[model samples]
Target: MSLLASGSLLAQGSESKEKEMEAAWQAAQSSAQAGPATVKLGEQATLKLPAKEVFIPQPAAGKLMHAMGNLDDERLLGLVLPTGDDDWMVVAKYEPSGYIRDDEAKDWNVDDLFKSLKEGTEAANEEREKRGISGLEIVGWVERPHYEAASHRLVWSMSAREKGQPADAPQSVNYNTYALGREGYVSLNLITARDQVDANKPVVRTLLSNLDFTEGKAYADFNASTDKVAEYGLAALIGGVAAKKLGLLAILAAFFAKFAKVIALAVAGIGYSATKWFRRKPSGSAEPK
Candidate 1:
């Protein structure tokens, strides 16, 4: 009877997992957009989200939560780039609600935002702890926020280290960039380890500049009388708004997957010894080389 019960439980677990994969696959296909073409950014502009380089433009955002297996609330995301090469992926979405004012960019303070982000990370760690996972800490920024008035572009990056990770241990970064439009903006995030950011930076910047904002939808087209302006400005966009966590962390889970081994040791409550046990031998180990 005990054996039968165990078998039944296993069957249920398998069925549940199968359903999840099917659901993820279907969702991914539903929102998937092929590249080398123009995709309207909610009436504000056109995005030439290319799919070459193993990049799949506008992939199903659900796959990032399910198939990728880590997240913090990515419901706002409308598009994703699943780069088959390495564990890197890019997420982009357009918020067309209104225009984001950049006047505050002139005196933006990094020290304040850094402090706010650390506090925000501490709060996020609480949730991680409840899930029997190791927590995280906001060490510092890999790149402080910078805004270019000419192009109406903003760029910044932050680094996070696992709780108890050695001081010299490697960290991950979310290199974020944004292009402001008359209606809203398009944020493109390159989720990767700190070491990989330099290599990936150029490509992502190119991607940002190539995104075409249609005429009358460009930042210069803002009509003060008729256009709605965002309640907050650039400073609020970079730092937390109202002391709440920056929505950026939601997608930072993409970095967690990139460093899966570190995540196993850091977040999953797993130790190094378990790795050896799970390691598989080469299929031809018994044969002569």
Candidate 2:
């Protein structure tokens, strides 16, 4: 989600705005695919969605993202939300920017990555404030960037708080994971309250593992002679490089300044409907929630 005018919600009138949100949520919930299902991520990959979660496909997912202040991005595949109250949501995106080289991960410096993240976020804050959203500052990494060469996967976590908020104030965390593919990569970013990340880590990791590229789309299947290479390397996904290329918020999407309140609305509107959706399923259905 990019930076949106914080007042955008209020401008629509509280009651009217909420009705729109509820309507969008309802539309999305009605289309959700109950899990223990196979969901194609465009043409690049597929996710083996577990029984404890639900997959909301595009159009509906895109609508929900818009209702929440994000622009309609074609890169968005869908949304992964838990079957129960997990207090987190995953935004899945696929960037077909060609093959990305992971060689930089070997010698990348952690301190430098941290420094670049702080600087990039500080710069992004100026834009956030201009749009009426609270300025955010990185509190430092909750979990440093870790890359798995064999699996071609990357994982990292960071916490942020609204500028001027007290040190003890509740913060938000963006726990990101990427799975590389021949065509490009797929990212699954989990947005949640900072305090809940540790408890929620397993859930996101499971989903990441469940996602697999199709036969010819696997990273190792890249054809050097014919394939295009991404301009940036793996490390770029972390800091300045990504901020410059993809925009900081595009990479982070950490719009959790008011996540608790936003999630409450999500649970009330989407989660409750999802529960009822499962109940509506026939007992003889092949996929049970």
Residues 1-289, candidate 1, lDDT per residue (tens digit)? Answer: 7999999987786666545544543454445565655666555566666664222233345453443345433323544443334445566666664898898788767888778667666665666666555677776877889999999999988887778999897776777888898988877777766787788787578778877788888899999999999766776556554235335553323333333332233222223221221132333332111
1-289 per-residue lDDT for model 2 (tens digits): 3346656654456656556666666666677888889999999999998887888888888877776655678888998877675667888889897899999899989888888777777676766667667778889898999999999999998888778899998777888899999989999988777878999888889999999999999999999999999977897778666776666554543333323334445433343333343334443344432
Instruction: Give the C-alpha lDDT of model 1.
Output: 0.60
Residue 63's C-alpha lDDT in candidate 2? Answer: 77
lDDT of 1 at 156: 88
Worst 10 residues of 1 by lDDT: 272-281
Clashes of 1: 0
* Per-candidate TM-score against the hidden true structure: 0.69, 0.84
Clashes of each: 0, 0
